[model samples]
Target: MAVTRQLTGIQVRGLLGRFDHEIIFPESDEFIILHGPNGVGKTMLLELIQSLSGTLRIPSIHRTPFSEVRLTYSDGTQFEVSKALQETLPLGEELEKQIQRLIFRLRLPDGQEISSTAGFDSEELASPRFRDWASRVLDLEPVGPDIWLTTGGYTISSLELLHKYSDRLPTRALRTGGGKVDARILAFLGENEVHLIETQRLLTLEDPDSSEFRRGSTRTPAVSKVESFARDLTRRLADALAENSRTSQELDRTYPRRVLQAHTEYPSEEKIRERYSEQNELRKSLSAISLLDENVGRIEIPKKMEPWQRNVLWTYLEDTEKKLSTFSEILAKVSLLQEIVNTRFLYKRLEIDRRRGLRLVSEEGTELGLSMLSSGEQHELVLLYDLLFNVQPGALVLIDEPEISLHVSWQKRFIEDLQRISRLVKFRSVVATHSPQIAGKWINRMVSLGPGTTD
Candidate 1:
């Protein structure tokens, strides 16, 4: 079953330098724009919110000690996660190594809390309070020092005191208003629903023949960008052609050789009689292959093309053409190629040649490489393609600095274009930008982040 989950809001405390205590209001609009001046930690706050979903793992050095994040879902359920750094005693001058630990607590509507802590001492699992808490919340009765807790379909064995729930509870009790508790927990952990677009979103398309063709600081080859949509279209076309070839092979194998000989020239009565017998034998073989009676002769081995067969073949060809046309239509709809072609005379059409990569044909019959496009145009194309083809529906998309490389006019229409694209893709987007032109008239949907801001 597909569940519709939306992030209502998030509260962070003592996480980063700027965000001592911050409350982000993301529920105001499906599309959110976070705009602020430089050094305000706008990008850091975005990263921290993304990390809280549990999809991204922060490095130990980047991880802050004594940080708490509370995320509220649309269903009123809350996920509260906190991390702390613990240090042991040192012998002399050298300090002891610090261990970072995490804790998870699920808050229900009835005021009940399901809590578990990781990185605790192994001996602590033997404590009576820990066992009682496990039995009540995790539904586990610990018999020994080592125990496992089964929650939300996954087994939690990190704590030695945790044990799997022995009794099977009612299905209704296990599920919250939205869905299963496990699914909610997984959703909070950024399972398949979070998409993070970093500030450095530009893709470098390096020309193999000339190093001067490379643009940007990155010198990555062209294969990375080409693999995105071009490869998928190629694979689909290959599969379709393979299917057609298989069908042709099947027809050839089932065709009778005697019928071919009879049709090669005008047949005499004797020759016709002999071919008729061969045809009967051929029918028998085909009947056996098709699991039908010999007399049925359902598999027609035509000596010559009939009018009805010609019509059928033409219809099949038309259907194949329609399949290819449909693919082109989908590509045109999802990408900005058609819009670019319609407005700008830069290209007349966009096509993919098997020998060459993506090609743009101009009005003057000139084939232009993708690398020939300006940086702004390339950024626009790549961003649209990634949004349309890469991200899934209902995903929380976090884009950093969308106005980079875009013209002032394009920046003004950025939110509008995003809104139109969202109609087809159906994703919740939170874009961080410094340009007021990008925000435009959507100021009501905008959230401002300031330095040393607290909730």
Candidate 2:
């Protein structure tokens, strides 16, 4: 994974014209939990962060009323997004008008600051030209005001629709009209990936085209995403095997030549046997996970061997090591997923099957359907899968209300499990929760957002 900049802290003022928050993330901590009373703007702060950090959603940003927001990054760069509030918005069509008063400013570590007035063309969004083009070209069916049914049968908001079709749309449609200056700023913000896992944990949170939503479920079953993920994992394993096969064949074709060119000096038989033993153990691990089809049969190693025999054995082991290295990352992810999930499951165990990617088998020897899992179980599986597979390295993951539908015990273990995952996945997390159990023992890492308080 490529290294990218991460958010170090965020400051917001005049949130809903009353709440102010300044959240500074711990430099070394894997995650930060925001806790406070209801209606204190915790979730709104997260949404503000999401809208400004990545893939700018103009409508959503406007929907979230705020005076000013400043985001500081690990690289010492900063972004300040503010808007002019002329009048209080009323409900109905009158509120849909574009204020066109947003200002975006980017400040670099070197002290250079670039600013632009960024706003979307509301006319284009409401125009029949764009609507007809979207429906005809993109296959998006207009289901409600500012809502469209994606080809997959799931609904998407107009803000998301504009984002999905931004590249192919007209230049003046959503661009800030600041020409190259705004374009550069948008591109810069786009580089910093930010994912928001909202309070709607049961529904699919990502775009419509994601593997989970592509199954054409109008009302997306949360468990279907898990099942689709299993199938996707199987495909990924097959691709990895194919990659290993290609690499092995190429190595084998040149095996004799490479061995012939090798030096005569060889390691001691004990050392050679040790390396062979390590490689065999790796094979066993892979086979146990169904990543490898062939069994790892026991090998008889001679206590003593000729120099030529040692040379051949060492070469073979090196080749085998290269072949197995392909699965190293994939194996770690799958193993961790299994370990965490199986430990939490009460009566079932998760097992990887080459044919099905993964399966839950009950103690009674019956295979359980992915959809049969309870809501809390589905939340655990889906959330973990997204964090492990969907999110990119160095991205900011904002999880809202992670304790929803989760058992109190599970909530207590949430932070520990997330910390373990963060260590392996190297990303920053900012979670908003109303439950004290989810906050756990990390008192120093908790930022309490209260009415009119800035912390």
Candidate 3:
């Protein structure tokens, strides 16, 4: 059974230019689309949601001194996260007056609230009375005017200490929300439930079953973009290949055992030799084909030749190319047979080779590498693959631009294809596109963002 989780609404103030929008998602399976021009806060809105979900760090691009975000989940759970900069006190009366402070607050579910404040004044941060207060509230003993807890503890200046505390204060508050509620919120905000597919083509050529993918290396940036999906697919494919290899070995062993039994029952040395010779010949033919197939992409015709000779060369090259194309198409069809069935695209094959990486083959057996694909085809393949394989059911997928490289015809079918894929995967999506063709007939779900608009 698929888990159902939804973001009902969000309210923001002083964050990325005062965005205040209530996104009431459809109770049905329909997804939302944020249509707007460039420079609007569409991507910022997605980042804010991602931050609220605790999956990403708060963007440093926010120039505002204070910001607040409130989120309402489908389960009636609510969260409000706020951050305020430390103010400066008047120079003359600073010692006599209360110091200015930076404040961080979080209002969790069940009406419970947690708040933390850090003073800006150096004297206040060093004072024994203030140290006692910190000890009581934050459980840290002051070792020196600039250090806290034990001698081996963090040895930072007063200002840096305050800043560090303020930065992590929200996470601390989350910890205090009662174990069950805290766990639930963390799970809800986890990467598995919230996916953000940024607009960048990051790919690297390496073995899929290599240690890099298995141990989750950061050297591959594209892997991080689709981390969970890549990890899961890598494991599944590696296991499947290993199992198939084992089955083949088992069959080979069984064949010898069967032959030995047959020989004991009715032995014939000439018959055995003839059978072995035939099998050897078959294996040699297969080996030759495999070697030729591996080098198909490198095959090139000579430039300097007579017309008739060139024609002959062209015929040979064309036949070889046809065989290679058919081989690629067969591989693709076998790999993505199920996906092809669901989407019904003219693309018959989608292959993620251990060595070659991703490739697409048309129904007519035209094979193309990822780089060789047209812009529209690349966009369609990347988006569809991410939606179908990466995103989990009931999760919110934030797509930046679905129509960037799509043709008008493809743009028109974009929403329809997305809707079909979403239904099959049981996930929800919020797409940000500028093309009306991409928005299609889902205008009811569209929220347009314009210049100087709060919502």
Candidate 1 deviant stretches above 4 angstroms:
20-28, 54-66, 88-99, 108-112, 117-184, 187-192, 204-329, 332-337, 340-349, 352-357, 451-455
Clashes per prediction? 4, 0, 1
Which residue runs does candidate 2 get wrong by more than 4 Å?
1-4, 85-98, 122-126, 131-172, 205-223, 294-300, 452-455
Clashing pairs in 1: 147-162, 148-162, 148-163, 148-164
By summed lDDT, the worst window of 10 consecutive residues in model 1 runs over 161-170
CA lDDT, every model vs. true structure? 0.54, 0.77, 0.52
Task: Estimate candidate 2's alpha-carbon lDDT, on a 0 to 1 scale.
Answer: 0.77
Predicted structure 1: lDDT: 0.54
How does model 1 score by TM-score? Answer: 0.57
Q: After superposition, how far is residue 87 of candidate 2 from its true place, in Å?
A: 11
Task: State the weakest 10-residue window (summed lDDT) of model 2.
Answer: 210-219
Ranking by TM-score: 2, 1, 3
Would you give me the overall lDDT of model 3? Answer: 0.52
Q: After superposition, how far is residue 32 of candidate 1 from its true place, in Å?
A: 0.6
Positional deviation of residue 31's Cα in model 3 after best superposition, in angstroms: 0.6
